[model samples]
Target: MKFAALMRSAALVTAVALIPATTATMAQVDGRAGPEFAKLFAVFQRVKASYVEPVEDDVLIRGAIDGMLAALDPHSAYLDGGDLQRLETMIDGNYSGLGLSVVMEDGAVKVVSPFRGSPADNAGIKAGDFITHLDGTLIYGGSLDDAVAQMRGPSGTSIRLTIFRPGRDEPLEVEVTRGVIELEPVTHELGAGNIGVITVNEFSADVGADVFSAWQDIRKEAAGRVNGLVLDLRNNPGGSLDESVALADLFLTEGRIVSQRGRARGETILYDAETHYRGDMAEGVPVIVLINAGSASASEIVAGALQDHRRALVMGERSFGKGSVQSLLPLGPDAALKLTTARYFTPSGKSVQEGGIKPDIAVPQISDPDFALRQKYQTRESDLRGHLINEIGIKDEEMESDSIADPRFQLTADELKDQGVEDFQLHYAMETLRRTTASTVALRPAKR
Candidate 1:
């Protein structure tokens, strides 16, 4: 994503008040919106004249702007100076915070997913948990920015969170210390039998280059030529769309990677492979992509593209369905508008809006004792209010199929722990790749 680059230009913020217009011209332009405009002005005048106390024009104007956008969708928002700086910081610098991706849902701050290895993640903050209070203060019906600000503090400082988990009977209280969140966008490991595991935490700047370098490092650290590859995107909340394209292009040679359709001409664009990278990075290696409820946006883009082309076997829980693309339109020097501009589609013309990417092999993280409980309450894009609906309707049954327990995957966490399997999903994926030979792996597209 060119989020940082988009902040350089100044954009015009359209206001409700018009300069001067004839009644007929205004009627022709806005389909007789004079009465609607009159109502809005009347409300503003009444609110200004009669209230508990006098409210500042700045506050009222900002509230009006926020209310207008709130009526449209959840993703669209007015970003003030702090919001812009925070977005930039998340992309390029480190900050001391709980390191959790959260969104306001019905005025409650709900955790999307905690960053892997962050303080919140270590504190056992799971996705779909609603944070009700911070430091003993009830934060219900508060702005998301304020809740986020309260959660962030200097390193080593502790904050108490009152969380209302869905299935739990009582509200859970947990204390967590803050730390500097140094986002490791791309991480790699050399597994046994010359298997390489590249875990993409987020699609930030230079992620494609980082993954390429990771493959080099894994090859150097390996005992023999690389036999298998695993691209782990679990709990990755996504970032730059361009980086997602670049990452997918690393493995794909030639095909439509993704396409975005929007009202504007510029928003509609088609991305293909052999553009960012020349050829497949791991040409003949058996590949598997791991995703879960926390994988969204750019993560879904990469997973959907790879799965559509049959480049990798996607194995994990269904992804967080987020097909819409948000474009950062700079409002001024210190503010911006993050507006949902387009909906992206996979190569198969599939929109992962409400119904997220379904894994080819549904593998639960049975290594965690709380897997069943967490999975039951796991939130996806469909859980968000005013979220974009898929152009094609989604079946309730389609979304529930992954939750069904399979006899082959009935191993309990304690049983897996006794067998030394800390992560059952990854362990299973690596094992599947190990037994497969290079000759059996198809680097080219299979016949339809």
Candidate 2:
């Protein structure tokens, strides 16, 4: 039987396909790789018979299989049961690192997305850029975990990265200082004009309910009617799929919310509005979903659904474009396979693999004084090596959320600064709602 089939259940899909099945392979030694397997077995026997010290069969076997899977993709890896528990603990609370979401692809370490304000983000490391070397050492064929381990060190120290961005013909070098990554899953506040700003830092557990409570708090804090809402998913590396669906359902009353398609029949599933909630929580209030290159997975799921259903006006830059679903399939009681089982699509059937969800209004963040500095180092999914083909065949330039000159955005960082605007993206979205009536944002039939 196939190794993946050994899993008892495939449940709890995550942003990165983290399946914990047996790291062992079940394929028969009868294909073109048959000769290769024979060589591996022979090497194993030789090592066992004449090694410097005794090496256990399971140790050698696990190493061989791990090496095999490591070559597959960035997200695919073999985690022992202990590693699995450690991962769970990390996800549940704390960790230390340079605060980057990285993956291995095509033998190169790739940055998925640096946490907002992370050392990597501050250093201008964009998504979709290839990290070929670390500290001048070539890491093209290194393990993702090892690379991450090397990147994680005493906070406040710096590391140098040699990056190859697609748009640029030449490679660029960046130096980033490492810092601890503390994930604050959700935070909210009621801004002026009774507009509620909910910043979903990560898609961890209970986020849907948390956002719902945030909305209730926003209404209570408001002196009058809530005018608008801003779902700030910027720099949010997506988490729970169920939370994404539930969050989208907060504003969507009807229609298909999102769907997943996969090779296995079971992986193909449809999620609809009201699957988790009864009615639109913020029925008439204008919702602006803010996304950027860091927004991915569950973040894309929420943005795509609301944009497709016309339930919200997605603003800010394009998302991280991680549309694939990773299911945690249990191999035994302790281990599981976090495998990429399906590609998620918007209600309109648009795949967000390389082509992330484009906002209704493309708003660039020029508010920060260092906006230009940040633009120098940007990355996205399309720039990733071995990134799933969009099939939509989107041009690479479209994926570049880097600042392109637009005359409409004449406001310099100084201008925005003078206006007491700290966040350009959220400020612009709020100003738009203040000027435009909510009726303008109401659901309408697509032009097509």
Candidate 3:
């Protein structure tokens, strides 16, 4: 299809909030800052004149640009060359590599998560793994885009990755064969009790359309009206703002899905149901959204909207709060400015800035033995240095706590295994659907 240039506010923030692209050029430095500029220039002159080795102008300029944006927020950045290309590739969603969503932290390339069935995931790559090297060559201290470019190659090739995983005794190496990554935005699987598990891997272009198609397929396989749904948004770093809104609109017959506010005239906009899709596709079916720390940005938009509207009961851990939106304002042919232009709010007027969407039902995944370890090391938008704080202040405890006590999810990992619950979170969601009537599916004690 069809596509448009949108924002990817990332480093866990990845919702390309929809806004009209402006022809506005970067304004000239103000006369008021002439003194400041002179001082900076003076420093530059001294360095160039007195330093033993000469420093290039491009190097100094790039450093200054990066430094300015870095101090603003973790998401804002100056994009050029490979950085811009990588962003284009994310939106395009088709490439050659062991597919993974990654970010740079403290000068190391960290795995946000592997695409569910990509070569990376197939090779047993897990989220939170720090990729230390590629093919025995150290990649730490390099730019994230450079690391990403090195990992990619033509299909059928193999690359060795040296990973340093937290809670592990030693670093590990994994060999993943290259594959052409076809970024299918949505995937569905029909589980027991006629439960449709629809996973939104990313908010790439036409993700709403993809989910609609997925629902149709699930229903066809179901051979009847699906009783319930589990919208899996786990490990989704995020993508297109239109796709996120469109996806939420599919399940909301009427209501505000999300709203973005910014100082600029173009940044303020509201998305509502029927604005993109006609009506609720899964209107009557009870819905449970699956999210975790990896779920962010556009992921939070959908979860927050559905949760606020009572259209779906959200489950799993707290989402990676990344409510801000980025806008790609072209600086020139070779470079662009990726700026955090707006902050989004949910239907209930709650801002998922540093505090992400909280699931109505807190269900933990006790299936993976590494689950506890992952939680300890899991990163979120709030965890990022220089991340924007919510306008409405929040306490540290609110962001830190995952769950209190819930007897329903009190089952141990071994207990869940005994019940053949390989995926504890999804199983719990589906089981809840099977056991409860849709109207009374609240997060209270189980009814007799």
Q: Which candidate is the best by lDDT?
A: 3
In model 1, residue pairs whose N, Cα or C atoms come closer than 3 Å (at least 3 residues apart or on different chains), thus clashing, are 1-240
lDDT ranking of the models: 3, 1, 2
Decreasing TM-score order of the candidates: 3, 1, 2
Each candidate's lDDT (Cα)? 0.81, 0.74, 0.81
Residues 143-258, model 3: lDDT tens digits: 88788988999999999999998888899989999999987778889988898999988887678888999999988999967899899999888777788888888887777889
lDDT of 1 by residue, 83-149 (tens): 6656666755489999887877888998977888899999989888999989999999988878889
Better of 2 and 3 by TM-score: 3
Tell me the TM-score of each prediction against the true structure: 0.90, 0.76, 0.90
lDDT of 2 by residue, 1-448 (tens): 3333223122123543334434554333457887887898899999999999999988898888767755554445565554454455445445656777666666788776666667787787766678998899999886676787788788778889899876577899988887777756778988777788999877776788889988988888895489998899997777778778878888776788789888865678898876445678887888889998788889999998888877788998878788888776555556555666788999888999888888888887888554554566666666654566777788867655565677867798888888888788988888887888887865552443
Q: What is the lDDT of candidate 2?
A: 0.74
Per-residue error for 180 in candidate 3, Å, reads 2.1
